[model samples]
Target: MSTLSTLKDRIGRYGVWSVGLRAEDPARRGQLAEAATELEQLGYGAVWLGGSSAARHAVPLLEATRTLTVGTSIQSIWDYDAETSAASFAEVDAAHPGRFLLGLGVSHAKLADQYRRPYSALVAYLDALDAAGVPADRRVLAALGPRTLELARDRAAGAVPYLVTAEHTAQARAILGPDPLLAPELKVILETDPSRARTLAREFLAMYLALPNYTNNFLRLGFTEDDLTNGGSDHLVDAVFAWGDETHIRDRINTFHEAGADHVALQVVTGGDRDTLPREEWRRLASLLG
Candidate 1:
């Protein structure tokens, strides 16, 4: 197990979350490494590979930076069995040691045909990880519910809850007590106009809106059916996304910190290409956060 005491110091107060970082093409490895290097220089504490990222996906990023921690925002249990996950963890850790975090998740029924009794399956997965000697403190859960949150507290390092509001972070902190990592991914739109920002947020949030895991969490956070419809209401969009001027964005991000998040993984939502890395936007955010 990792030294729980230093997890916060290792992860730091902020990270950059991006699906683009999980590029599988071998040709893009150099570019990805350069981006990782720049992110470390930019003062980001960590890099979370978005989507259903795996432990293998973290290797390149970890190799590209010395101090910056690299985590798979979630490596689905369905995609890799406990044995494979543990082996991958061992391989990566042997080279990078404490720089890798194995983020685990059950994914969704709609996305995985083998999905079954997610809670129970997640428990079993944890059990397997334990048997395979994967340290609890070196991992995290993509938890959104009470039971899973408790599981994160009891079985893993902490949680990396996605698509959640600040209030949920507060509740999760309460459940987590005064320890363990609480890093939630917050979507960001650099646009200042409400209409334009909401449009961009909606376009990106549309797919997640169709997932019950996220929608149910929204409902639990007091959002209504209408709020979940048509790519979410403006209120819902505004709550989950930081999309205004620099001052407003800073305040929005601070709310999560105030609510007890150890770190906030910022995911920039752009109007242009989704696959390409938003380096300019990242630079803007680095300056804004600084």
Candidate 2:
């Protein structure tokens, strides 16, 4: 079967997106592996490591699960050059073929001192990855805009847009046409109360709001400056995040699929410390989906 077809089969309708899954510390390897195993057992087709994760961070999870596809939600172009990324992809794919998806992105200027000519740099990076033999089908991009989405369609497997609305998903699918993967990362808060949910969503979204890339995209999506103020307005929060009861959240997730997302990478926000795994929330999500 073709690699794209294999990806469609391997990554099911929904997957877990978590920064806690990144195995940066040696001591967390076992815990990370165990969590990955449970996620696989819970019937999640993939686990996307959040933050600027690379193929190396996916090693423990890939090792622990036989079929769960582990991917970097984004390994910034600034963080690792294409040659190093290609080597990591080669090393990981050799150990576990057809199981790793290299998700690349040009992160925000605030985070990367080297951020410049991002679009052009991304093209060059893809060119290098091509020369290094990283199959286009095995990689994805953290694309949010039209130009990058076009690059994702033409150069890579597909687009995995972060912090997008269903409206953006529809627009992206229109750009990508029918073939490549379109997996957008969605934040989920299991809370039912609007007051509590929006508060948590605002707290989580505050950092992203400061970044212009996201703000620009929000504007492009039809949100106003008012919507972007004070973390995020209710309308903006409600649009981007899936919250409330199980049924409500499920319906919200379905909107993305209806809008043309092949997979939704769900990141659960618990209004707690970032380090904890939030396994119970994951379990609830699995059951909710089921």
Candidate 3:
């Protein structure tokens, strides 16, 4: 079967990326499962399990939802080697088949004590998956800059870039050559009040701002050092996050689509809290996107 075909058109054009949807969370299993099923009923395309997820983490979600594509916003490469990762991937596929997609990434250097030669490590990892019979089409790389994006185009099914601007989506499409999937993770603040929304956004943005992988991408996308500093300039924050009411959110999603994103995984951020499931926001977004 073709790789994208396996992903299925059910992926539609939009989906949710959430850190709170972790399968490993001991307290939220039943809640998370019901939420995953609820998402499919809502007509949203996919649900990206964000924040250092493992392939094992995708299983319960897949078992909960029949057709919803549950992918890792990033399965941190630093945590799982290719062989072990591929084995876990196979386990999930055995139960759910094409209903799962693996989104692998070389996580931030500062976070991973063993981080080194990321591009080279990723290359070797992809090679291992290839040998393990993992289809390139069923996977995506969390690419940011040019070289990794190039690798994503050549080696994986496509790229799932996190915390990127619409312009970055356009640039990624140019590299991907019209066929590879371009699903950028877009942060959204559902509040209508600009000050409140920026306040909420900056809380989430502060941590990412410290990560060079993201800041460097901002630089590549024309953001200055000044823009990257001090909790991110308004221009930089505005570019990275979609804020202020439903109209603003829709416009931002459409901008990514217009710029070349085939699918956008909306990561909803409210008051910088990641523990609570944003079901209300997910429901609201479903109505707008549909």
How do the predictions measure up, each by TM-score?
A: 0.98, 0.99, 0.96
Candidate 3 lDDT by residue in tens digits, 1-290: 55564454658888899988875766767888899999989988899988999777777778788889889989888898889988988888888878788999999998999999999999999999999989888899999989999999899889999999999999999998877889999988888887888788887888998888988888878889999777878898888888877777899889999999888999888774686788998888888776
Candidate 3 ranges beyond 4 A from true positions: 5-8
Off by over 4 Å in 1: none
RMSD of 3: 1.4
Q: Candidate 1 on 1-290: residue-level lDDT in tens? A: 33776988877899999999999999999999999999999999999998899887887888889999999988999988999999999999999988999999999989999999999999999999999999999999999999999999999999999988999999999998778889999999999999999999999999999999999998999999999888889999999999999999999999999999999999999977667899999999999999
How far residue 146's Cα lies from its native spot in candidate 3, in Å, is 1.1
Ranking of models by TM-score: 2, 1, 3
- How well does candidate 3 score on lDDT at residue 248? 77
Error of 2 at 132 (Å): 0.8
- In model 1, residue pairs whose N, Cα or C atoms come closer than 3 Å (at least 3 residues apart or on different chains), thus clashing, are none
Q: In model 1, what is the error at residue 128, expressed in angstroms?
A: 0.7
Best by lDDT: 2
What CA root-mean-square deviation does each model show from the true structure?
1.2, 0.8, 1.4
The per-candidate count of clashes, in order, stands at: 0, 0, 0
Task: Give the TM-score comparing model 2 with the true structure, all chains together.
Answer: 0.99
In model 2, what is the error at residue 232, expressed in angstroms? 0.9
Q: Is candidate 2 or candidate 3 better by TM-score?
A: 2
